[model samples]
Target: MNITYNQFLISDDKSLLQLDAICGFLGRSYWADRWSRETIAKSIENSLCYGIYDGGKQIGFARVVTDYATMYWLCDVYVDETYRGTGIGKKLIESITSSDELGGLSGILGTKDAHGLYEQYGFVRIPDRFMRKFPG
Candidate 1:
């Protein structure tokens, strides 16, 4: 399977639409509702967003919030349900981690279920320094 991993710019409407589709497949309707089209447009424009396309259609999405020097928080990683288990996710993570923009930083993410996948890429659980803050 030849998948094209492309850098997504803010002006990419097709990529954004693909992202929306991927999110829906992942059961992330909350994201679909919470983020307006303008918000997604802005995110693509300013953030590090990547899309994996099969032929010409998007099948995976990943975003990175990075300082471009120190740390990168890998977030919103989702592969279309139909495309899961075929190494698209691995390729997406590899593509992002190998980029000069993120290669040297500490990559971090918290996954509810895909810890094993992340761990294979050298992401270990931080047993001692974990903390979170939620809406009160």
Candidate 2:
């Protein structure tokens, strides 16, 4: 899907993504601070990616790991620092959650912050119902 908000365009076209831009942003993120460019590329290759752009420059990004049927995990959500507070993050999430590709599927995400933001879109903390096992 392609959407326009003011001068910005959000698209799911993987070919439109800027690898260096995405890795630069995600590498600095608290969650993926240790991620290598190769890892980021591999992740994008395996998941559904959304790219938010201004003119031709990438300004935001998000990805979803899903089966396109039963479940989806939203991750790697980020908007360039300069683009924050302009509602681009919300629009990205809105576009992802509302896409027909994920219709009727359950969505989940983990964030140390931004709970309030996700809550606005019907996400709720499941209170001890989820667990994780990181690679050792």
Candidate 3:
């Protein structure tokens, strides 16, 4: 799906992704600070990626890893520092949640500091119901 809001555009077009911009953002992000470009590219390859752009430049991104039936994990959500507070992130989330591809699926995400933001979108915290095993 492709959507435009104000000066920003959000699309699921993998061909439109700017790997350099994505790597630059995610590499410096608190969650994926140590992630390599190769890893990022691989993740994009395996997931449904949403790219938020300003005209021709990429400025924000989010991805969903899912089977499109049972479960989905929302991850690597970020907007350029200059673009925060503009509702781009919320729009991105709305786009993902409303998309036909993810309809009726159970959605989950892990955020150390964005609980309030997610809660606004109907995401509720269920204590101790989830677990993760990160690779070393």
Candidate 4:
């Protein structure tokens, strides 16, 4: 699906995704700063990816890791530094949370600084109920 907002667009078309731009977003993020380009590429290949565009240039991105019926992990969400505060981030989250394919499944994400943003979409701080384990 493609959603238009003003002159920008949010699309679930993986074919429209630009690898170089996505790498730039993830590479600069504190959370995913350690992620290699290959890792980012492989992750996008296996997950449901979304790209936000200004005309043909990719300006934002997000991807959902999911089991379709059980739950989804929203990760690697980023809007270019140049596009911040334009309601693009909020629109991106809205698009994801309201998507027909992911609407009914529980969603979780890890954000050191975006708590306020996600909370507007019903995500609460559940540090007590969340846990993680490193893969071997």
Identify the candidate with maximal lDDT: 4
Among these predictions, the greatest TM-score belongs to: 2
lDDT of each: 0.67, 0.93, 0.92, 0.95
Per-residue CA lDDT of model 3 for 1-136, tens digit only, reads 9999889999999999999999998987899989888999999999999999998999999989999889899999999999999999999998888889986898999998999999887789989988889887
In candidate 2, residue 61 scores what lDDT?
93
Residue 63, model 3: Cα distance from true site in angstroms:
0.9
Worst lDDT run of 10 residues, candidate 3, spans 97-106
Question: What are the per-residue Cα lDDT tens digits for candidate 4 across 16-67?
Answer: 9999999999889998888888999999999999999998999999999999
Off by over 4 Å in 3: none
Query: Candidate 2 lDDT, tens digit per residue, 1-136?
Result: 9999988999999999999999988987999989988999999999999999999999999999999889999999999999999998998898888889985799999999899999988799987998889999
Candidate 3 TM-score, C-alpha based: 0.96
**CA error at residue 92 for candidate 1, angstroms:** 1.0
Candidate 2 ranges with C-alpha deviation above 4 Å: none
